[model samples]
Target: MSESEKAARLSVFKTYKLFVGGKFPRSESGRVYEVTDSKGRWLANAPQSSRKDARDAVVAARKAFAGWSGATAYNRGQILYRVAEMLEGRRDQFVREVGDAEGLSKSKAGAVVDAAIDRWVWYAGWTDKIAQIVGGANPVAGPYFNLSSPEPTGVVAILAPQESSFLGLVSVVAPVIATGNTAVVVTSEASPLPALSLGEVLATSDLPGGVVNLLSGRTAEIATPLAAHQDVNAIDLAGAEEVLAKELEIAAADNLKRVRRPQPVDWAADPGTERLTSFLETKTVWHPAGGSGSSGAAY
Candidate 1:
């Protein structure tokens, strides 16, 4: 090809931005940092999120929580299933991004992408059934009936795992939304492209805006404000280093936020109900039993 034809063949680069309030916005700080492949090759620039960005995410999540949590369990299941469908259609793109992010061979990356998609499906199936598994009637004396129900714990901030970017991210995030809680996710600092790309898929899916917010930046810088934010009800430090997790845990204590500390995880293993149950709060109601004509007091 001649130089003129070659110039016309130049590829258009993509600008990676934070997914906040279901919209792609540059960081409030208007700062960006270099994102490189695992081999140190320049890839793209990702927005370096700031404390203000973190707060914005919390506001978005909080705004989305009531509607999301109020939706029927079956409806949440349908939306999560839709997410899986969208991911399946974009399988190839995720395979490429995961491969570059983790320095994996194409075949290995394909397996990870498959696992992530399947993880979404797995969580989708649990949406309607989780309450049954965790909640039920309780045995009580004195002609009183008691029952327990699981409720969403409002806004949850999740730190996506550093190494297993796609699969680990899916693991932490899918369960949160599937169970009717909105999330503010901090993607893998070193490998955030896949997570950011996933945001596009979510936007197109039927999920409400702000149900899942994605932030790409220095993990510690973004996590600090989220951990301390009064609006955030829970935090999952899945990607934090030991010291950082401990510090964030302490910060979360200020408002008695539910904390899930970082732990060594096998992303390929079948994730049990632990993640689903972590962000749930059990609400038990007691009612006095009486005849149909009698007034019954409930508490």
Candidate 2:
């Protein structure tokens, strides 16, 4: 064989970076750790996000929260649905990632990917209707109109589940953004490649930058600062172990941050509105009953 035919082409490796402020950046500490498949075979090197990186993610999420929370629910739904569309288009790639990360067969991994995409679509459908389900008019025996509405809780920190990887990660993340809250997500410690890949999908979708920042590193190290961040409004400890969850919960109490403790969850099962509501706050308004000429007083 000739030299051209005999020489094999070198495979170009992908540089996995943290997704912060809608840009791909190496960790602030410039560290990376090998991400491996279920059988301990190296898949790639994922950015080892630092405390500074976590803080940066919070800054991004906080900066984006106003615009994201202010957007109309219908518009938010449209963006989330667009994410589902993008995920659907990249189904095969996720299937391979999930299969490698979770030690599943191609068909099983494909099923998980399908579930994740569908989960995104499901949350998309909830965006406009959650208010009606969770908020409404209250009967008051006074010359006043009382009503309550659900509002986003601002920046949320999420620990992506270790076992389920892609499916679990989507399950935790889609809901926070669906309800208008921005998120800083720490990917699975052992299996972060799929989560990093997910950042690429989110970047391409209509979802705004900083709406969902992705970080990969030691879960405990990344989560500690987030739990205590004064600017962070809430945290989900789905991926934290018992001891770590307890520690983080205590730290969250410093700022009275909303905490969702770690619980055994079936990632593939029907996820109800709990995750959606966990990071939402209710704002109740009491307006005096009035015509145009009446006093514009609110009690």
Worst 10 residues of 2 by lDDT: 290-299
What digit string (tens of lDDT, one per residue) describes model 2 on residues 1-299? 67887677667899998999999999999999998899999999999999999999999999999999999999999999999998999899899999999999999999999999999999999999999999999999977789999999999999999898999999999999999999999999999988999999999997899999999999999999999999999999999999999999999999999999999999989999999999999999998774535565444
Candidate 1 lDDT over 1-299, as tens digits, reads 99899989969998988998999999999999999999999899999999999999999999999999999999999999999999999999999999999999999999999999998999999999998999999998666688999999989999999999899999999999988999999999999999999999999999999999999999999999999998899999999999999999999999999999999999999999899999999999998765544454443
lDDT of each: 0.94, 0.94
C-alpha TM-score for every candidate: 0.95, 0.95
RMSD, one per candidate, in order: 2.4, 2.6
Candidate 2 Cα errors over 4 Å, as ranges: 1-7, 290-299
User: How many Å off is the CA of 171 in candidate 2?
Assistant: 0.5
Candidate 2 local lDDT, residue 47? 94
* Residue 149, candidate 2: C-alpha displacement in angstroms: 0.3
